[model samples]
Target: MSNEFKDILYEVGENAVRITINRPEVFNAFRLQTVEELIVAFQRANEEKSVNTVVLAGAGDKAFCTGGDQKAHLSEDGLYGPRGTVGLPIEELQTAIRDLRKVSIAQVQGFAIGGGNVFATLCDLTIASEKAVFGQVGPKVGSADPGWGTALLARHVGEKKAREIWFRCKKYSAQEACDMGLVNKVVPHDKLAEEVEEWAADINQMSPSAISICKRSFNADSENIRGISFMGVQSVKHYYMSEESKEGVRAFNEKRKPDFKKYV
Candidate 1:
């Protein structure tokens, strides 16, 4: 499975399948190809009878994921590479994680920012290492996640903290995240894998069908999520394609502060 993916690492475990974003050079920031691969990997995990859980991580200690790859993002074509025309692949991937019957765990180590933070939030549980950091870099980078990034995040951390996260683009430590109810647990960096394995073992001992039903029940707020996310996604699509979006991207690439003071 590792040989098949160009942007990710897939390994089937005794009771779980571990999917790690492989692009560590960029702090594991994802592009269109990466999200598509993740959707397939999670779907495969959902189908396997022996697989009672799915574990998500990233390749390096630098970042679990930094969200969209700002270095080369072109917006419209990201959902399906350079050909397809949609920017909602991450949105689709979020629903996949939540809707799957098997439990999903985000084993975050570092830099789960912006959409990356959303991915971790949408999972049934998140276990972070002491080194992990969570926040949103979207507004600073010409983007935002209206999906799990805001609404669902508020479900975990409450409205005020969620707003602080997205609006300020500030970083939160692993302990800070756990304090806000954003993550289930925070382990020492060296013990992360063992802790996650223990959690997976606990999950594997549960009844699959019951867990499935529970996940569905938890996701009953889907209607409101879809409505809010639909508007957010559409708004961002236009924002991503706008001249302001290009200026932000250009400034990021240039390693300077985006002079947004002149925009409005």
Candidate 2:
């Protein structure tokens, strides 16, 4: 295992590579450097011949990740920048998650909120702790866009549930997420690592080439429609940057609920 200052650790063992988010102080909140490191880790895992499967987990007991670093996102001028242009560079993180060829699993332990939830859903499979809580809190934080979260959430839980999650910023438990098909499995906190390792062992026993091909096939089918939908949704980001979104941000920063009633 290799340790780093940023919120990432890379380890290779027993035909599997494990990447852990290492910032427990802030609930493993993402910084821009963390995204870059994760990209590097994913590339390394993809290129390594000895690694047949990849696992993602967060360090500590509290949270997998709470999402973007709000303090990091606040500029010296005190303004929130556009989604990918600020904080953790979510687009790059999403691209890295999307590029993993080996079977990937997210072993989520606790809070998986906002961009954190997006990160977990990007994996091929998710094994969550029974105590974990997941949600998209961007809306509450004054962000109009959910980044790549919309794509994966809609695919996993369908459009209505996805809309409810993002629009309402409601938190759901691991069991609720599992019942809604957002997670593959939920195990006790103590069993998360063991269960993930067992699953990875089974995956590692498969023919690497065959597993890679199967992953690609399923990934393409799963993402094709959502990709097109994302393109369309992304085109409207400029609208999110307009006065309405600015007002949303301002209202949030001021600790008052937005007055969108007039727009309604």
Candidate 3:
């Protein structure tokens, strides 16, 4: 019940473990430490005898998570270099997501983009507010790798749609994402938490062991599927630091559309 997490808040209640991203100053952007904290939190929840479900959300009204911290990424070491760098703990986070034994739900409000979308898609179920916007904006920021998104998204929305989102950086509304099978449900902003709680309550009524077994069965089939590759850390860093990526970043910062037309 302590709100002591540096970048997130953790609480246990109603047989559920709730984790809220707390960095509203930058719209809940994920730092290396934040991702590491999430992995530990999820692992702890998995071990707790009293917890049957896990819920993830953001602290503020404006964003569930905007993505990685761009300012951090632009540092001298870049996003994938050495310890305490952006994207390094992402693989660990993904492992935690795949290994979660209990039902996990993402309660999304606004702007679940890039790494945020990756995190949400890691959950077993995604419950979004009608005002939420989901996108793979990493391409606009200079990389196309959505770390955990490569596998989870293709499973939810098909390879074609996933490719479009990743390669083109398309944004989808909550309703659109639900229609496309990205989100499980979309509710009003004011009722999102209530809806999630109601759904969690219903899910918790089922046999936890049975649910866990079924989830394991479903994941087993896709365990070896080609998804995000951590081996490409150097390549991703190179891409982001490339001239094209610089142009993409500049276009985004300048509020103009990127001219990737020529690159294609």
Q: Which candidate should be chosen as best, given TM-score against the real structure?
A: 1
Ranking by lDDT: 1, 3, 2
User: Which structure is stronger by lDDT: 1 or 2?
Assistant: 1
TM-score per prediction, in order, is: 0.94, 0.85, 0.88
Model 1 lDDT tens row, 1-264: 567999999998876789999999999988888989888888888888886889999998889998878776753532324422245476678767877889999999898987789888888899999999998888897777777678888999999999998889999999999999999999999999999999998889899999988888888865488678867787777677776776677788799999776765
* Stretch of 10 with least lDDT, candidate 2: 76-85
Candidate 2: stretches off by over 4 Å: 76-88, 144-147, 225-264
For each candidate in turn, give its C-alpha RMSD to the true structure in angstroms: 2.0, 3.2, 2.7
Residue 202 of candidate 3: its Cα lDDT?
A: 81
| Ranking of models by TM-score | 1, 3, 2
Looking at candidate 3, what is the lDDT of residue 51? Answer: 57
* TM-score, predicted candidate 2 vs. hidden true structure: 0.85
